[model samples]
Target chain A: MHEFAIARSLVDAAIDVARNAGVSRITRIRCRIGDLQQVDGDLLGDAFSAVCDGTVCEAADLCIERTHMAFDCERCGTTFLVGEWDWSCPGCGESGSHARGGDELELIGIDGELNDGNQSAPKCV
Target chain B: MMEIKVLRNVFEKNDRAAEQNRELFDRRHITCINLLGGAGSGKTAMLESIVPILSQSLRVGVLEGDLATTRDAERIAALNVPVVQLLTNGGCHLNATLVQHGLEALMQHELDLVIIENVGNPICPANFDLGEHLRMSVLSVTEGDDKPQKYPLLFKAVQAVLITKCDLLPFVDFDIERAKADIRRLNPTAAILRTSSQRGIGIEDVADWLRQIVNERQSLVAAP
Candidate 1:
């Protein structure tokens, strides 16, 4: 499902940071999704856990935050949240639609543990 | 444990690939379209009817995406136009990486217009960006007008919606007005065209809509 792909992206991003920073284990990942995107938090959590298994992100806790998308009405100059698939402006009845893009689906950050001296000693050579 | 602040879009990787694809298409003066719809929505049928019409004035090509079959590609190939089949191999949708490879194969033709017929699904395909100038969705009358509300994301993302199988309207309980209203609520600017590939109804209008975009690109390329 769509949630699985998003979960994969989140895990990959966390892993990328871990590798680049020489972190041995990732503990948590935080993401923010837009209201317009139809992502179910429960499904996303399940997918994240599924994809993180056996990876550096294994057992990592995933935190999700939802954000609202504001629609700018060109007619009445009113910026508002579109309700129930109705893009029409409440003030002027002017329909406002914004192109969907990566404005949503954000990965805020990650928490990880640095490698121990013994584990990182091999890289010193 | 160390806290790191890395604010990034989850779709950044795919969006970058799509931007690259768009750049490539722009350089080549190709008007690429991402065609999406549910299974049996008459996407291929629309292409089968309109390809010939569009080909008369511009060089046309197709990149067909499906779960595990070359059937749609085969159908497009039969039209004697350049076509490529992108097999997702059980994947629900086609991503930008797959489309980049498909575009490489299709690049040799020097096409003016390329239509990527996305895998037959309304929901999954709506999430992906395959480096297209326009995103069009096909919905047949048999699926009912209420479908737009059920799958609002797809309706919201598409620039145009083709209500196909209009010939069957007399036999079905599909309310065309309700369908248009639902679509307009989500997308006020999407051109909702009624089409029946079987009867050749509204085929010219669909072709003309595409033709205008392609010709605009052509005119821009010709400028300077």
Candidate 2:
């Protein structure tokens, strides 16, 4: 559903960056998605394939890195990885810890070849 | 090989649109509330009940989001207020871009409060922001009490939870206490209110709360 929209953005961003870097073809795209986004990796990959058709990123590969959710204990100032929705602080046994990460959906980097009016080696820009 | 680090959020466009919408609302001194709920969570019914009361003292406008119908807009237009229906075609959720367009149509009139009734789906709509001052989700007793746990993102993102269809609470097996407790656990700061638009219960309180928000914004706008 909305994965189509997300994939469209991802492809567009990759193309924009590749063109800005004077690269003709995007080899791969590295993305970091947090757990809180709740995006289905398989669905996003399918969507990317569908959206990449007829675009510069048609042959590009999408690499996704899932970030785990973590929480910061408000009472004890201890940060811990959330285990199965457990909000209790292991240090103080107190509930209601503030969420501290795992909601990111960012494009980390891109790997492509530079087309500087001549043949050149593949570059990760 | 060159490795260029972009470090850009995929939702950057949507987030930027939402920020622009917030700026527009602030500049106009308008309080916008994004009303979210399931298909039959009494979102339209609650609006039908509260709009009249809210229109009594404050200028009100509504942006109705539906997959493919103007029926909700027709209903709100009957109230004689500025109402715009946004057809998302088959989109599951309304994004900030759609809301930006809706606001352009709604702002033609001098409105103090604008309510954007998002397309009925708890999961997808929870991920998108429509640039509203407040986000309120409606849950009917018929939807069951476990919804808060099942749709944690929707429950956790809202500033208020409206338990609609309270008149049917006695007949249904929905555990109000458990639902409230779950909502509290997920969002301790969210205001939970029980409302029955059919029975005219808690309508005044909801209207009063909206009025207070509008008044507060107006004062801020009027201040130095």
Candidate 3:
């Protein structure tokens, strides 16, 4: 349900970048998602296809890169990775209030081709 | 064949809208809170109990989000305060854009505190920020104590957790201490309060907490 809204945003972002780069076709759109998002990639992919219809990103591939949750203990200063909902620091047994990473939900980049140029080099926009 | 690095957040649009909402709230000197919970978690009941107490000192407003019904708004309206019903149709969550519209409608009244009753799913609503000063979630005894572990995202995102329907705790197998421990594991700073709307327990405490927040905001606005 809400994935449709997120997918629409992703498509809109891709189209915005493509139009700015003067690209006619988009090959792929890559996203980095964190564990906190709890999004279903399959559902998001389906939603992306549905929302991208007739748009510049209609044929684009949605590549989702999932990032795991990481935490830094404030008590012992031990940085540790959370396997699944485990927030306690294994070193000092203190529950950390500080999070180090893994809450990312960003559009990393896009792969596309220019309309006027035959140069196939990847444009890092 | 070329890959360009965009490096933009997927929630950038929503986050930008939320910032705009925050600016509006700050400019108006209003303290907004997003109330999140499951469908039958007694969120409306808790509001029903607290709004009266809150309205005695502070001007309060409510924006009710539901899939299709205006029933929650009706409940809040019975308290004789400013209330708006937002129908999401079938959307699982309420986004910042919707909250901006809700604020626009609610801003007509001079409210000190505005509580947005988000759509009743624990998962999807946790992912979106509605530009609230405080985020609180209601969990009922019958919903089971393990819910905090199952829905860690929601528990982790909230600033407070209201354990509602405590009157039924005698019959239910809800382990309050265990639930509190689990919630603390996820969010060390979240305030956990036990409340029973039917018995009028802990309603004043919630109201007093909100009042403190409103007074703080008022002082900040009054300051240079």
Candidate 4:
């Protein structure tokens, strides 16, 4: 349902990265979305193509990297990854453990060929 | 051609607007909370029970955000509390921009606590920050215990979790312990409170928590 806005933002980001790199066309866009975010892959895919109309990323490939929520124990300082929704700290049974590396929504990088007919890959900081 | 590197966040614009809202609330010494949950989570009912009780001690106002209808606002108005309703039409969630508008309309009256009842949806509302000091989620026992598991984003971002409709716990198959465990697993720090707006169960506790939050915010501001 809200995938339309997310798709628009993703495409907008890819186009910005591509245009700045002097690439006339986009080959692929890589992203990392967390499992906790509850994003539907199919809906995002559909929205991406629809929102990319007339944009530089019209034919770009979207690659998604998925990760589960991970938490670190506050008392014993133990770190573990959780597959299910339960987020208890594995070490000391204490709550309020800090979360690590889930809930990410980022455009990691873009891959495309330059207008001069040479394949180019721009590295992002 | 020269390349201009841009690493802009997709939600940077919304975050900026939310920051402005935070600044405004801080300046006014108002404690704002964004109440989120699925439809029929007892949001309006919970407010109906708490506002009058809280008003005895503090000045309170509400900004009801919904897709259509001013029904919720009308409910609060019956209690004689200052409230404004923002109609989103077909939008799924209420963003910071809409809330900023709501604040302007609500500021006509002096309010100590401003609770924004967001549109009833678990997923979309998690993405938009309405410039609130805290986010509280309402979960009714009838909505199943796995709701926290199903929508982790709402649970993860919320400052506290309120379990509503507790009066029916004897009739239904709701697992209170399991639901608490599930929420703890997702959000270790979220304060869990159980209540039933129908029976006035734990309403005072909820009111006490709200007062503590307001007092804490005041102390934080008064700190050097």
Candidate 5:
């Protein structure tokens, strides 16, 4: 649902970066997705490929790095990464802690090749 | 060829449009609130309770965001107020660009208070800011008590939390104190309130808070 919309925007951003860099085609895109974002990686990949039809990023590979939710305890002033169902502070065994990071959806980098006179390779179908 | 390193936020474009929308609202001195929650979390019901009460003195309008159909918009129309429905078709959340477009449609009615009912989903809607002066989170008792723990971002972004469906609290095992504590653990500063649109419980309190926010926004705009 909304993952497809986000994937479309990411693909659009990758294309914009590639065009700005004077690249003819994009080879790979590196994205950082947080665990709390509720975005499906497979769905995003398929949606990206489907939306990039006839665009420069049709064959581009989407490299995603999944991030985890971390929290910092206010009482004990301890920071820890919450795994699975446990969000308690490991330092003081506190039940309540404020969340930090792990909700970001950002594009880190894009790798593309500039078209030169020698490298006239045909496009991949 | 030069290696270009552009560490850009993927939502940069939408954020820019949202900024523009904010500027437009500021120039007009409008008190805008973005209502966000999961599907069938009683967002429209909250609006149904508050809008008519506020319209008694203040000019109010609504901007509805939904996947399809104008059902919610039709309900708001029953009050005989100005409302515009922005259908996303299949989009998961309403982005800033789409909200800007909807604002243009709402402006034709010359509204004072614009309540944007965001597409229902705690996850996707939390990511996009719809260019409002205030963000409010809506949660119903039927959605489970652990919703605040699971969807922290929605509660974290909003200034207040509205817990709806208190009338069914007798039949269901929804711990009101636990829900408040869970929300406070995530957001210590959030204003919490319990409401039941069916039984008219806590509706007046919700209206009073909305009035306070609207008045505060207006004073801030009038400040030298």
Candidate 6:
């Protein structure tokens, strides 16, 4: 439902980054989405494509990397991916809770070309 | 030709807006609640039952977020409480920016507590923050026990989970204990309560929870 909003923001953020580095055309957008957000990757991709119209990232491909929600056992101290509705620590019988790396909705990076188009300037964003 | 590693959150703008709104509420000494639930999850009914109880002692206001209709806002308005209805125009969820705009109208009233009833959605609303002090998700008994597992993020992010329409338990196949247990697993610390707005059960408990948060914020503002 909010994929369009997210895609708009992503395009805006990408444009800002590209403008800063003197990039003229964007070709790719890499995003890391976590399992916790209930986001539909196909929907986000379509939304991204729609929102990128006329922008530098118009032809950019949205690459989404999915990650599972992980839990670091409070007692056993072992980290494991939380299966469907299961918070039990796989290392031990103790109950596990979400610790880290679950709720990720990051725009990891963008691939674009420089304005001059002679030699691509690879400046870190 | 160039790969710039941005490594930024997609919701950064929303998060920043939410923080600003949160600061405004905190500075005004008002406790805010972001009420979220799926459609027909009894959110409006729950509010109808609790608002009167809360208004008796505290100055309360409500911001209703809906896709199109003003019906929810009208229901809240009938209670003689300060209410504002934000029409999202088919948007599935209410973002911080919308809430920020809604706050402008509600700010006129001297309110002790403000409840922003989010758009009826179990999935999308959970992803957005509305600068609230407390997060409450209403899950009606008719929705079944599998909801928690289906929408864990909503359950996990909330501080309180109100299992509404408990009076229908005998009529429906929903298991109250299983529902509570599922919510408990996803969110161990969340206060889980069984409520039936139609039957007037557990309204005071919900009111008490709101009061606890309201007083906690008010005392902090009054302190050195």
Q: RMSD to native for every prediction? A: 5.1, 3.0, 2.7, 3.6, 3.2, 2.7
* lDDT digits (tens) for residues B39-120 of candidate 4: 9989999999999999998899999999999899999999998999999998989988898898898988887899999999
- lDDT for A117 in candidate 2 is 39
Q: How is the predicted docking of candidate 2 categorized under the CAPRI scheme?
A: acceptable
lDDT of 4 by residue, A1-125 (tens): 77887788777777777776778877677788888777899999998889877877777767787877777786888888874555667677676566666787777767777778665454433
Q: What is the lDDT of residue A101 in candidate 2?
A: 60
Candidate 3 docking band? medium
Which lDDT tens digits does candidate 3 get at residues B33-144? 9999999999999899999998998899999999998888999999999999998889899999998888778999998899999999988898788899999999999999
DockQ score for model 2, please? 0.44
- lDDT string for model 1 (B122-203, tens) is 7778888889999999999999877876677778877899999999999999989877876775677999999999999999
- Scored by lDDT, model 4 comes in at 0.84
Q: lDDT of each model, Cα atoms only?
A: 0.84, 0.85, 0.85, 0.84, 0.83, 0.86
Ordered by TM-score, highest first, the candidates read: 6, 5, 3, 2, 4, 1
Index of the highest-DockQ prediction: 6
lDDT of 3 by residue, A27-116 (tens): 788899887777888899899999888987777778888897666777888888765555578889876445545567889888877886
Error of 4 at A123 (Å): 14
Q: Which residue runs of candidate 2 sit more than 4 Å off their true CA positions?
A: A71-100, A117-125
Q: What would the per-residue lDDT of candidate 5 be over residues B115-170, giving only the tens digit for each residue?
A: 99999988888888778888899999999888887887888768999999988888
Runs off by more than 4 Å, candidate 1 = A18-24, A67-103, A114-125
Clashing pairs for model 3 are A122-B2, A123-B2, A124-B4, A125-B4
Worst 10 residues of 2 chain B by lDDT: B148-157
Model 5 chain A is weakest, by summed lDDT over 10 consecutive residues, at A116-125
Which candidate model has the greater lDDT, 3 or 4? 3
Point out the higher-scoring one by DockQ: 5 or 6.
Answer: 6
State candidate 2's TM-score. 0.88
- Better structure of 2 and 3 per TM-score: 3
Best by lDDT: 6
Better of 5 and 6 by TM-score: 6
Docking class of 1: acceptable
